[model samples]
Target: MFTQRSRCLLLIFLLYFVNKISSKVEFTNIKCNTFDPDFASFEYCFLKSVNRTYKYLSIKVNLHKTPITKVKVNIAIFKRYNGYKPFLYNITKDACKFLLLKNPDPVSNYIYNGFKSFTNMNHTCPFEVSPQKLPIGYINQQVTDVLPVPHGDYLFHSNWMAYDIKRATVNVYFTIS
Candidate 1:
């Protein structure tokens, strides 16, 4: 049903449209079947909850093997574990990624707010009362790290607080390996 000219134009349009989207890769099917956990919020532009820990938050990125060059992630604590407030403690910098590891003492920009300190996510030292300051909720490519984790339905909380707020957000950005 197409005239020669019309057919040519349609073909060109289709080719252009295909070409426009061919180079992008979206890993958006964020089901637990795709990730370790079956329950994750797909509200982020790109988000996945793969932990570096075998049992919990152990995630690995192949910065050396793929186009992903580098990654910078921050871990933030929340007012409550699963209820995101969207504003108050939304951390805009790197914090908890250091505490989640085995020996995250090298990262000077973090605090180990005790995991039990859910009411106050601000414990800079003593590393005991501050569970958020532990590396259990962190991921880093720095010198030697350990992926500490717990089992089943654990949400990684933020351990960093540069302001007077209580909510937090741990962010990771990478340039595909």
Candidate 2:
């Protein structure tokens, strides 16, 4: 008979499930091509050998002369290559190496040049994730940061608002064996 409010609701549900598994962070998600960029196979899902995997890729652009102001699109994550690798490989591999988070630091070469960058709109290219030198605050509109992705296919380039510059390209594919 476990009484006393059922042991305080099982100790607050085991401390909220162990603090959500100790602040869980490790990703592999490539979604946001619900097709509409003049769909014609939408350019074959922004092909590049077509195989968009992921591990921490977030892009949200919607700012055309203000109102919903959002501008946070500069995520470069890659690890393996041609064969692909590292997408939630259990998170620990240095938390998915790659960091250039928030505040005045997001533009790993090329944007507004060649299909508005994001590595030429998501294409499983670029091998080597050691691009870090960012440290502080300039992504505005709804803060959310944790850019640590490495292992394979990575290219996140977006023009998510900041005066009106349309572009979206997020192709995160990672794997580690």
Candidate 3:
């Protein structure tokens, strides 16, 4: 007894949940040493987590030898088709200028933002955390920010934060969509 629009919406919603349950994230292997060059580019370092039922992507950047001030990360989520496709929307800089301009540590940023759910309709990172940092390290496996991504095959790319910097790893946990 559902209307056509309601049925369509329900189907879409079900498909979204199905993709979330079945989707997997795979990360490329990255080897890093303290003496590695600054701003090194590493390939196959994207994230891929599969069959996860969570509702948030937990991004953790662990910093050991590398200082937090000397790290930076640029993350982009791309959709997978025959080839990888980038998300259509541009991340709003002003919406999260507080984190981008101020450069607060990851823990403080998460605390400031609080635990708010990120859905398909809402893709903005909270004011406390921005996607990229001039220099970044050690998020302590916290929910740094809400990723603007939907279910299905998507590539998670990070720059500067996932390379040869001693003991630094960028970990992203995607929640169920």
Worst 10 residues of 1 by lDDT: 24-33
Off by over 4 Å in 3: 1-62, 89-151, 161-177
On the 0 to 100 scale, the lDDT of residue 48 in model 3 is 29
Clashes of each: 37, 20, 14
Candidate 1 vs candidate 2, TM-score winner: 2
Per-candidate alpha-carbon RMSD to the true structure? 20.6, 15.5, 11.5
Instruction: Please write out the lDDT profile of model 1 over residues 66-134, one tens digit for every residue.
Output: 221122334442222365333223334333444345565532333333222332324332221112222
lDDT of 3 by residue, 79-177 (tens): 666776675422212223334546755533443343233212123332122222111112212212232234455443443432224323343322322
Residue 125 Cα positional deviation in candidate 2, in Å, after optimal superposition? 31
Native-to-model Cα distance after best TM-score fit, residue 10 in candidate 2, in Å: 1.0
Ranking by TM-score: 3, 2, 1
TM-score of 3: 0.32
Please provide, for model 2 over 67-157, each residue's C-alpha lDDT reduced to its tens digit, 9 standing for 90 to 100: 2222333443334456433332211111112222223223332222212223223321122111121111211101122332222343232
Error of 1 at 70 (Å): 6.5
lDDT of each: 0.30, 0.30, 0.36
lDDT of 3 at 19: 49
